[model samples]
Target: MRCLWDCWPMRLTIKSGIAALLLSTGLFGAASAAPAQVADMPPAGEGPRGTSQAVLGAERYDAIGYAVPYDGGANPGAISAAHPTLPIGSFAEVTAIDSGKTILVVIAEQGLATPDRIIALSPGALQLLGRPEAAALGVRVRRVNPLGADQQALRDGRPASARIDAPAVLLAALRKRLPAPPRSVSTAMPRPPRASNAAVNLGAGAGYPVPGRAAAPSVRPATSRQGTGFFVQVAALSNGQRASDLANSLAGSVMAGGGLYRVRLGPFPDQASADRARADAVQRGFGDARIIHE
Candidate 1:
């Protein structure tokens, strides 16, 4: 019953309020919906943001090069070295590939210092490593973090900084490298199963010896820097004494490395002997026993 003109403003105000309410609700819904959708979808790429996928995908660095003798330039008696990859002020383990002798040396210099070589040690350092006259001694340099006290000693250029004693278990391995002995097959036993698809070749151009059986694909014999002959790997245990005990029982050898003690059987003179030993080990409840030809 209200007059149209008197009611027009009121009706317009109500409509405007309703519209404002709808607009606010729509904007709120839109903002909330976008975040929810984003939460459901994982970010793309090899990893999430800030991961810098390149670092995660990069290959591990394996340093293999030569160690050359260097006359002490400014510090003749200092046990120091010039390296290519190791940072200055850091310590490294330089091992002779042929002699298996290992020594710790400080990195006093760096840069393009060693062109093709991995490290250039001082004359004293080289002598300590027992490679004083070696021009291009094949070496593998391993990085190590020295103790704070040792770091101070190394900084002072003390000989003790370079002194290191090989573990008893690793003593034999640290000796001079030798060529592997000849492998002879025993005709007494039937041909054993191949452990791998890859063929094994004896050096001196020797071929497989099975009669009436097709020889396996010929592959080059494996070479070892420290010359570890064929052996059966029994187990890697935490206790070195336990490994020693096992080794004693089986006439095996205990090799300590990588924070574990390895119990191995037979650096047998030949492969046939190792195979027989491996078969025996498998029969003796070592389900994981396998010949380590490498």
Candidate 2:
């Protein structure tokens, strides 16, 4: 009877061992079927990192004054412009200082080809910024939304040099002191002055061309310089032929300047005279006509 009781204890011990073994096997299988606990957890450093967080923030430059009459091919109305260094087709937001208005524009062609200006916005973009027909304005520009690659490039890249800002009051004052540029003259030779009796003259019948009329009075150089007179700019074109054509069509003189060939009415003596010419230009379909100084 003692031996049977001992065997019963052994049998119980065997059963317990088997149950524990089966439980361990089931746990091992589950562990093998599923990923490790740490593997299931979020990636390392993910707790502090987020999609909104940037490894390096975007760079911003200080104020730059942009010039007007931007030219970007056939689509003059497009809210686009050109920059000297910014990648073409990239997007940027420009904020006007005085009006506090902002505009989104795409970099289109090459800029004004000058270091004096940063980005040149199209007329449409300028109008959207709430300042239409402004010759120049102080503005801040920065990349707003960019492509993934562009963002990466920008983050890794160095910021561009800030453009030199022109002082408003100083520039205005200097402009007031500037002298008007001389008008363009045709290549046609001026009529020779009539020879006086005291001057040596070729004998007549030498096929020499005689003066058609009285000699023109000589223009003496002014002792004191005059200020630059006002002018009305009708059009600014890049194509020399097109500009010449427009100038020929217009009644006034043409001036080539500001990166694009310009068609202007006159170097009128005063703003009042320029206003009258501008009115005439507006009547002839030049709606963007504006007064200009040399």
Candidate 3:
């Protein structure tokens, strides 16, 4: 069976003025701001190491506050970001304007110095907040206690405060700042069932196991390959022809036989080869090149 994959193009606009100020004034400088005293920190053993409270509000830096460069496809599971001052791995709360939902994300990458925004979230962060279309949004950087604990609390229905030092206060503040969820899009694709353990082990062993004859492998139904590499299309094209044209310009071989024109990297027999190709493409200016396996 064949599947049509759509890559979404992301347009990033950086606020250059803010980038200059952050570099020159050192907005994150410890000397400019008093070092957070132990008393001001969360209670001991409350949150994960390096966690702190954060707040989300509107503030203008340079021209654009956030930049979403299409540096390959963004993963929806990772909590990465680009920030001007907050160190990588720092956590923050991102709220959407359309949805009243809020998600905590971690800083993953360094943002462009051109845009003067406080922080730029990873593509995964935008998806979690249900605002993948939004170019900019309000964010609050609070001092979180434990880094990943609050995320777990949100997922498991436990109170974030219970795992951290400040529960009541932070929850109350977040409730007011959260954004509403985005409208759902209709697609023919159906979600796949969860994976099973026996099947998992067989794949993990790669058609070989212990020296002795293992139990006969189960005859599981064949599954569709999810391409060797994955990429999110960032451009908005009205038709496959336009997509094909763009793909050709990028020197990407087109796979348009299936109605969807896919700009692909290779007939790579394995994922590692595709990954290397993707890296090479990025260096050559096709920063959006992604791996999709046949």
TM-score of each: 0.35, 0.32, 0.29
RMSD of each: 23.8, 23.7, 24.0
lDDT sort, best first = 1, 2, 3
lDDT of 3: 0.39
For model 1 the TM-score comes to 0.35
Candidate 1 residue 150 C-alpha distance from true site, Å: 2.1
From the highest TM-score down, the ranking of the candidates is: 1, 2, 3
lDDT of 3 at 181: 23
Judged by TM-score relative to the true structure, which candidate is superior, 2 or 3? 2
Clashes of each: 0, 1, 45
Among these predictions, the greatest TM-score belongs to: 1
Model 3 quality (TM-score): 0.29
Better of 1 and 2 by TM-score: 1
Residue range 1-294, candidate 1, lDDT tens digits: 765645988889888888889788786356666753433212222111121122233332234455555444346477787655555566766656565566667776432233345566777777777766555566555566555666676677775443343343333332222122112212232222322211122122321122112233333332232245787877644344555566667766655432234567767778899889989987888755767765
Global lDDT of each candidate:
0.52, 0.48, 0.39
lDDT-best of 1 and 3: 1
